[model samples]
Target: MLTALGLLPLALLGGWSLHAAGDYKEREQERWMLDLARALSSAADAELDGTVATLTTLGSTPALQNGDLPALYAAASTLARAQPDWLGVILTDDSGKILFRTMDSYGAPQTAAPADPDSLNQVLSTHQPVAGRIARGPRGRAAFPVRVPITDAKGKLYTLTAVILPDRMVRLIERQQVPTDAIIAIRDGARATVARSRDQKGRVADAPSKSLVELMRAGPEGIGTAVTTEGQQVATAYTTLSRYGWAVIVGRPTDKLRAAAFERMGVYGIGIALSLLGCFLLASLLANRIVRTIEALQQGAAALGSGAPLTLAPSSIIEIENIGKALEQAEHQRNAQERERAQLLDSLNRALASHQTALADAREAGRAKDEFLAVLGHELRNPLSPIVTSLDLMDFRDEPGNRRERGVMRRQVQHLRRLVDDLLDVSRITSGKLQIDATPVNLADVVRHAVTTSSGQQISMSTPAAVWVMGDGSRLTQVLNNLLSNAERFGSSATQVTLTVDATHARLVVSDNGIGMSEELMARVFEPFQQAPQSLARRTGGLGLGLAIVRKIVELHHGEVTVYSAGAGTGSRFEVTLPLSAAPAPEPCAIAAPHVEGLQLLLVDDNVDAAGAGAALLELLGHEVRVAHNAAEALDAVRQKMPQVAILDIGLPDMDGYALAAAIRHQAGDTPLRLVALTGYGQKEDITRAYEADFDLHLTKPATVADLQRATAPLT
Candidate 1:
């Protein structure tokens, strides 16, 4: 019953709102239609003034009087080209024989002129400005003709100038300030558009167009609503062209106006909906309170019938107030039961944390131990890659038992020796004994020597003659050798390794068509023990230490290295930058002058066989040879013979090779003799120790036979 009471008032309010909204909307649309009609009528007046200016200019031009028909034709042509909508312009004698006419009834250029006596008769009889009936124009276009008298300087009328009105005015009415849903036009009393916008089908029917004809006939100050023959209901307004005796009528669709009215009505409907909603809310609230009171009292009665405790509600109606006191007692009992359950859950969480602590500790310890093993493996594996690549090259011998294979094996052994040397280098660097012997050196000479000595990839050098830099010759050569070796080992054999020398630094670029690296690999390629780990790397085997050493040595000389790659299959390029140095001049020293008389040479090694073998090799290069097993014996030989070259081993038993070299240099002041250290300790720091001890040259264990011959050749 309460629900029904609430709904009754809401229904009445909604109906009233809808009716009011509809009435308001109708008034608004009527106002909008009136304003639109006025704006269009005013635009037509401006067009008439523009037509007058066009005609006056053509008649007054001096070029028209000389009987130059082309000049006059050009003037008329200019006006038409400037305004495509222009119907045509005609100049005629007072008798109405056409003098010049350009109105083509068919879509063709005007070539012949024709006169109409009927049009002349009307003009003379009216003795006033006149307009002609709408006629089909070029291309079936429609236009209207307006005629005015042309007079001579003596005030005697000589010609008639008629302008066919352009149709753009009608098109302008249709598009400008006109609504798409509304149809509008400017027309004469006979009802034809001077200009028209075409319909979608390229045809505009006379029926929809007929409303304008009716409005125009009604004369100026006309207004009406009619269903156009085209099946549209529209409102039209008209005003006449006072100067031309033509009427301009504007038609707008009536349904569009009605729709606008309905749109306004919807706004009012919203307000009504809101008012009705407020009434519904008020009624619903009152009904709910009454129904709830009755429900509570009925429940209390049921509890009493069952002999159970009853609850009372605090109702303003007072009948159910005692029910609230009974409910309060029941709620208190429920709260006590909830408290006991929560206590058990909290106790369980505390026990779990204690049980998991030891397991967590054990996992962290295991992770730390694993990281240590990975670093150790990387260090051990770094040296083995270059050796593997060199060894693989050896096994590629085409024939069994060939001496060529022996040479390949020897190269692989040298590769193994280099790997061992790099390991010792890392140790020496860590112990902080790396030293530099700065000298003014010819960098171009060093480049030629390095390129000539490097074995694998195709090496080329383009250096300016006599270019120089400051660096230790042996170490600089070592730096270049390392770079060249890495390029040959990793890049393809056919790759071109180029050495470019400049004023400030030398740039070495080693490029290969072998598999390139992605951005990720290029980033870490020079990092210690990091190489491309793809199948290509397996084919182009390396421990990756060569590039790392190359980078470190270049850095040691204050230069840089940059790598570029075009991604995986494209091939990689490595650039090594080295500082430049100035060339040195020959200096006077204590050692005997260059061989006017043959200079003696001494060589030493802890391995007696290596000592004899090296001396024999030196002699083959045309150098006098003296062999010794240790540096002490080599020094004693140096004192006895004062040899021009002394080659000593670093690991000699009696004393270190570095100490012995120092003693020989001290005994022979400013010795011109080249003190070459031949040793197994070929690490970078160990070589630095040799230079510091005044040795002029440093050669590693198992140095290539060609390398030994070249070192001795300088002394000879």
Candidate 2:
């Protein structure tokens, strides 16, 4: 009678276990479907985000910013060719007039408007990117546009759009490993199908069934039963992308899901029935023995819980013995895991310490490098000052026979100066301290100045009367000179430079017929230390920083530069485009040397060569000059003879130029002394400091005769 009573409870427990198994299976399937929906939603968002980013980058191009439709068309064509999933790229005015399309050739008239004008209007109103609804695109294929706004140089609004084919989204959905019978679809905000796992191309743009639409409207994400467009009822899981209001729906047929649950329940029921029957038979045969074994197991389990060693006696039943063995193995594993965790923690601490140490070392190394570059620039500029002064003096003398020699010497000096300047500019650019002064500048003047500075090259020039742009004149001239010098260094004897102006942009092209760069060399040509291969002599000598500086400067001015070559020995071409400015070009003025002569001046420099050369040049320019080698000498000269002007070098042996200037002022209490600071420190901070020290003028080293004439002109 006791066995019969126990069998009744066992049967009840088996029935409960079967029901629980079926419930668990259904819940598990629902969770899996939800996870799959979330994954698909994330994938779709990523793809759309990529398209938006690409459109943003394209809109920022100088061609688009300057309203150069042909250039923009070319760029769009290249981009479309590169991306197979892009159906076309179009640029339109705010009124939906298509200005250019990649599907059409350059300058081709396009009358067809975009399929989705609401998205373009949204972009224009918000000035942000928008992903449009799927529709029949211009080519009669179903696609969507990813649109971004572009404000041109004149502040006119335009929309740049990339039409994306639905196949990409279809591929994204198909890549997910889902059940064969499952249905997956991505729907736009309007409930139109964008992509579906089954017959995507055919079902695209179709409206979802009423039931599915109701389910989607219920919440941002949920699981429910809905009838698909195909009239099949499914258990659907959906998640909405927050950015674009798109939905990723994953569903399995309701009948199939129910069938799976029922199958699991049946298997569980059969297993439970067999287990109950076996237990009953065992109870009938050996109930007393089983009872004793159960009591022993209870004791052993309690002992293991209390951290006591397990001790189980031999049992006739193999399953009971195996259970005891498993308990013992669990204890061993716990202890082993504790030891392993401690070791792993120690290793992680050591690795973290090492990483911190490496990071500190790298920072220290960067500081040291910056300091070295500063000191090197100062040291190199001191010698060049004397050389440049001497060259100017030679020109002033106009010795008849040495014209060619003087020209050669001047060119070499200028080259060395440029190299030093490039090094300093690189340091500034790396530290994010390089700055430009923007004003209305003419490209014709820039070309003339650059050609004069880069004299030896046979450059063919073509430019309009005036092409105005907004940038730093000196920096723009530097950019052109670098290109000219690069061509001369790498090209054959002949180089050509051309300047063309459109309505909103100016194009500067420099071409050279020399040994062209290989594809590998061209890839990294703008990197700081990248250079083409050189022979043992290295006839073309440079630190390989010119082009890097060019790129940085051009970008700072909101411009673009590119290089092209067909192949080796086929020549090379470089193009630079900058937005045009409406500001009119300034009238040209001829600056002749000031008529100041025979003014009493004191020149102070620690370097004897620099001071002597400078004094000689001043004397040749018809000025009476006294040379001083230190601040004390300068002060003494001021006391002995109150000069009209004092050219002070910042770095001196006894005292700096700032203090010396103050002393000289005190010595000549009421007399006006024009203080000119001529030093190798040309950084912006240094210039600011010089002005703060009551100096009348500040000139960097290697000043030309023209610079000196202007400085002394005020004194006269």
Candidate 3:
């Protein structure tokens, strides 16, 4: 009696499990259908709202307000013609009479036109835009009208109505991202289908089932099992799209689950029957056998499916023993793989963290270096200015006996300036901040000018009246100067440099019969800070940046620089080639120097030496000069006697030249003081800052007499 009871309970439990599985399958299908319905409904709402918004924007156009009926008609026609879904755009009065319609014949009547009375009331009464029911037109045309209320300047409310085509709305529903086999349809308040995913559709009354609408009307969104008029069972769902009584409906066949459940039940029944037969046969042979073993397997499989721990009692059956052991092995391997994957993920996370830290450190280091260079450039340039000014001051004095000494001082200053400039250029180029002003240039003129500026020996050359190329004249001269200086530093007196021009290129060649380059040095010659050898680096008093600067400048001009050499001491050749231009660049006509006695200048600078020396030089050149060491003194002098020209050093103590320029302009409003900013800040940003501060001209420190004369001469 006890054994029979146990067997009966086992059979009942197995049957109940099969029934629950079938119910879950049906629920899954219903959920899917419900989601598809909502998605389709959302797509429909978006399309309607977009059409309404476009028409509202059009109603705001000035053409509608100006009472330009023809212009308004033309614009509305264009809008309607562009959108296939928009039937027409109509303008209506407060009483709902159509004032104009895009569909009307050109030059047609603008009054007595009909509009939907319901839409007009909702728009005027609510004073808000609203979408109304899909209604029939005069010719029995189906369309959805959206009403937008527009208030005029005098607070008169007008109605702008847009008519949307129903068939075109079907296109939006058909393109929705739902099941390919889903039956999608949009319905009106009366449950009439206005659009469908497929061609065959009419009313919810025509949907082969009134129950679909009744099920949907239960709530704003609903899902239910419904029966169609065709006597077919289906999963149906519907969702509300707007305040109006309209919905999107979706249906999927329910028979699929019914057939599937039947098939699954048969399989389950076969498996359970075999278990019962096995138990009875095993019990007849060996009483109460196979029950616990079967139960263990079932429990273990359930735990494994749920990713929970499995514990199985020992079984005498060999097959069950093997299955348990195999399962145990699989669990162990899975645990090992999980551990390995976790370790790998941890390692990857650590590596990513390390890389981010290193990247941040590198960026910080770069920023610190740039700040250091900027500060260093300013500090070095300030002191260098006075030295450079004093050199120019020497030009006016009777110091012929000290001419060689003066020349030496000037050359040393030039060398130091070049070295500092080279370092700054390297920093700028490395940080990608070098700015160059390129223009059409005559290469011959640049060469002559560079030679005049540098201490180059007689260079061999052929005459070309003008070998035109586009380049920065000063930077190109700097490139030539660096090359000549390099050759002079490394080569003997026997060295020769030459310039030649061809049809397509202008070439400058510097051939040196000195210690030529080895293969290694030549390979790395253009690399910054690369010298010929350790011995050469010690012998040459430079950071080996000249060639690098030369190469950079040439590349900026779209030109090329190359080197050729035999083994050490055999002779080396450096060649620079620039592209030629056909058209000649125009040169500015030289302005004649003004008589200094006719000029009055104000010199404002906190640097005592720079201010006094510059003023003395200007006075020596016959200009009436006034000097002030601070802005207070400068302002007092300006107030006492406003000078025609003010040369203000930007790095003043109390106020910067920019602020002083503004103050001066305020003090002498519209009197046209020729403000000139002379400062150590010569970068592009500094020059732009000067202009924004109201300076008429910006000159870098250590300006030649020619620059100041030319600048001040014009004012006189």
Those runs of model 1 whose alpha carbons end farther than 4 Å from true positions after fitting are 1-403, 428-449, 458-480, 491-508, 534-539, 577-608, 615-677, 682-700, 703-716
Candidate 2 runs further than 4 Å off: 1-367, 400-404, 585-594, 714-716
Query: lDDT: which is higher, 1 or 2?
Result: 2
lDDT of each: 0.62, 0.86, 0.77
User: lDDT at 311 for candidate 1?
Assistant: 60
TM-score each candidate.
0.35, 0.48, 0.47
Per-residue error at 165 for model 3, in Å?
99
Report the lDDT tens digits of candidate 1 across residue range 225-307. Answer: 76654667777655564445544544567666567556656775676567567867887898789898988778877886676
lDDT of 2 by residue, 1-716 (tens): 56557766876777687678777877788899989988888888888889888888888899978878889888889999899999889988888788888887877877666677788888888988888889875456898888888888888988989988898999888798888999999887676899999888778989889898888787788999999878899999988854777888899998987786677667866876677687778776797887789799889999999999888877889889988888779788877998999999999999887997889999999789777776787779999999999999899889989999998998788888988998888888877878998988888889877876566667778888888899999998889988888877776578888999888899999898888899888888888867878889978878788999999999999999999988888888989999998767467898775556578999999999999999999998788999999987887888778999899999999999999998888888889789999999998889999999999899998888988886678563
- Tens-place lDDT digits, model 3, residues 676-700: 9988887788999999998989887
| Model 3 weakest lDDT span, ten residues long | 199-208
Rank by TM-score (best first):
2, 3, 1
- Checking candidate 3 for backbone clashes, the offending pairs are 208-229
lDDT for 600 in candidate 3 is: 79
Give the clash count for model 3: 1
Best by TM-score: 2
Any idea what lDDT model 1 has? 0.62
Model 1: how far residue 660 lies from native, Å? 7.9
Which consecutive 10 residues in model 1 have the weakest lDDT in total? Answer: 199-208
